[model samples]
Target chain A: AQTVTQSQPEMSVQEAETVTLSCTYDTSENNYYLFWYKQPPSRQMILVIRQEAYKQQNATENRFSVNFQKAAKSFSLKISDSQLGDTAMYFCAFMRRLNSGGSNYKLTFGKGTLLTVNP
Target chain B: DAGVTQSPTHLIKTRGQQVTLRCSPISGHKSVSWYQQVLGQGPQFIFQYYEKEERGRGNFPDRFSARQFPNYSSELNVNALLLGDSALYLCASSMRTGGYTFGSGTRLTVV
Candidate 1:
């Protein structure tokens, strides 16, 4: 079983500043994918960024980026130019491609970290 | 295209009563997943259905059951609801090739 761990329960960042949220996972399989999701008070999970285990380069979308260290089993998300709208609960997730074709892939998620962007 | 859609934005039911939640996947999606998010906690997977068949189930008890229809719509039913079951129930839709797109979620309050 794969388990994602987010050590920080809460994080605070000033407006326009940068913040990094840490995430680590345990998985025996070498081929997998990592994702960062954001859920605001609305309770909707939104994909922030994704990293393919085979890719050496990190993934970035707008202000959101990921620092993926496959050897260390670490995948951290960095939010540059943080804004108030970015304040939300962030979760790290893991997904392993199944060997069997035509199968639905499952995701394992971390507890989450509450991020507050202070003005 | 429209994203994942879930009905009964909020529901309130007493303990021991049954509650049903509905979800409709995105236009082209074939997989739908259910998750529970308690206050101050992360969303936990409850069930996953693809092509109208059960694929994955979580650690939740059998009291929590869900089924997907041929149209890629799904429903989650909880029997003998407990106060612990009060939380936001989210439905996400995705394809085998990508990540899930989630709905706003239905808030279930078991009083």
Candidate 2:
């Protein structure tokens, strides 16, 4: 079983500044996937970024990026030029790499970190 | 093009009562998964159905059951509801593994 952990319960960042949300996981599987999801006040969860455990290069999507340290099991998300829209509850998730033709795509998520991007 | 759709945005039930939550997967998606999210906590996996078959189940009790229809639409049924069951129930759909689109979720309050 894989477990994700977010040490910061709440984080605050000013608009146009940068902020990083920390995450770590414990997994025995060598190949897997990590994801960061944001749930705003509307209660809709939106995918922010993803990182593959086997890949050394971190994933970057627009203003969202990740620092994935496979050895340390750390996958932190960084938001550059943070905007008010980025204020939300951020959750870090993990999924094991099942064999091809398997459909067990369940995700294990962390408690979450509430991020407040102040204007 | 419609993402995952869950009906009954909010529901209230009494203890020992039963409730059913519905979900319509995105067109062309054959796999659907259910999750339970409590306040101040992350979502917990409940069940996963693919092609109208049960593919996986999480640590939830047997009182929590679910099924997928031929159209890939799914229904989650919870019996003997307790106050602890009050939470947001989320449904996610995907064509395959690694990618998932989630619904806004149905808030279930058990009194």
Candidate 3:
């Protein structure tokens, strides 16, 4: 079993500024994947970014990037030049890599952090 | 292409009643997964299906059941609903190795 934790319940950032959301996880598996998802008022879960455990190089998607510290089990998301559209509930999730006989790709998620971008 | 589509955007049911939710995966996707998101919380995995077979199940009780069709569409049925079942149910579709694309979700409220 794996567990993901988001210590910050809420965060606020001014538009065009930068914000970082923290995430930590407990997993014994050596290979897996980490993800950040955002859910707006429309209630749709949208993928923000992803990181592969075997890759030392972090992942970056435009204004979104990740600081992944594999040894410490820490994966944090950095949103630069934040906009009002970034205001939403952000969740951190973990997924184990598919091995022999692994039939499904299940995501274990954290409680979430509510991010508000102030104008 | 159309994304994952779930039917009945919102539904309200009485306690102990039964409800069935539907999902239509993307045109080429062969896998479908279901999740439940409670208010103020992240979504929890409920079930996953691939090729019309059950691939994985979460910690939910047997009262929660689901099936996949030949077309890769899916249905989640919950019997003996409880007030705690009031939540948003999301459906996602993907290739075996790709990232998941989620639907807008169906809001189920058990009274």
Candidate 4:
């Protein structure tokens, strides 16, 4: 089994600034995927960004980027030019690589970090 | 195109009662998965269906069951619901390989 950990339970950042949320995982599998999801007050889980373990290059989507250290099992999310819309509960998730005939797409998530982007 | 849609945005049930939640995947999507999110916590995987077959299951008990239809839609049924079952239930759809698109989720409050 796999476990994802988000050490920071809560974090606050001023608008237009940058914030980084930490995440770590324990997995023996060599190939896998890491993800960051945001849930707002509406209770909808939205995908932020994703990283593939096989790739050394981290993933970037606009203002959202990831610093993935595969050897140390660390995957952190950095939000630049933060806005009030970024205030939400962020979760780190992990999924194993797909096999030939089995399903391994189920995501294992961390407790979550509530981010408050103050104006 | 429409994303994943889940029915009964919110509901209240009594203890030991039964509840069924519905989900409709996006067009052409053949995979649907369910998750439970408790207050102040992240979502937990419950079940996954592909091609109208059970593909994966989480550590939930047998009281939690689900099935998929030919159209790739799915239903999750929970029997003898307990207070702990009160939470947000999310449904997601995906292709064979890619990130999942999640629904707004059904809030089940077991009183």
Residue-level lDDT tens digits of model 3 in A7-87: 999999999999999999999999789999999999989999999999999999999999999999999999999999999
lDDT of 1 by residue, A22-90 (tens): 999999998788999999888889999988888999998999999999989999999999999999999
Rank order (by DockQ, best first): 2, 1, 4, 3
Report how far residue A63 has shifted in candidate 2, in Å: 0.3
Q: Candidate 2 residues B1-111, lDDT tens each?
A: 788999899999999999999999999999999999999999999998988888888999999999999999999999999999999999999887666889999999998
Regions of candidate 2 where Cα sits further than 4 Å from its true position: A97-100
Displacement of the residue A75 alpha carbon in candidate 4, Å: 0.3
As for candidate 2, its clashing pairs are none
Best by DockQ: 2
| All candidates: CA RMSD (Å) | 1.2, 1.1, 1.2, 1.2
List, residue by residue over A1-119, the lDDT tens digit for candidate 4. 89999999999999999999999999999988899999999888899999989999999999999999999999999999999999999999998643456544888899999999999
Least accurate stretch of 10 residues (summed lDDT) in model 3 chain B? Answer: B92-101
Q: Reference contacts recovered by each candidate, as fractions?
A: 0.71, 0.67, 0.59, 0.61
C-alpha lDDT (0 to 100) for residue A46 of candidate 3: 96
Count steric clashes of candidate 3.
Answer: 0
Candidate 3 chain A — worst ten consecutive residues by lDDT sum? A95-104
Clashes of 4: 0
- For residues B1-111, write the lDDT of model 3, one tens digit per residue: 898999999999999999999999999888899999999988899999988988889999999999999999999999999999999999999877546889999999999
Task: Give the RMSD in angstroms, all C-alphas superposed, for model 4.
Answer: 1.2
lDDT of 2 at B35: 94
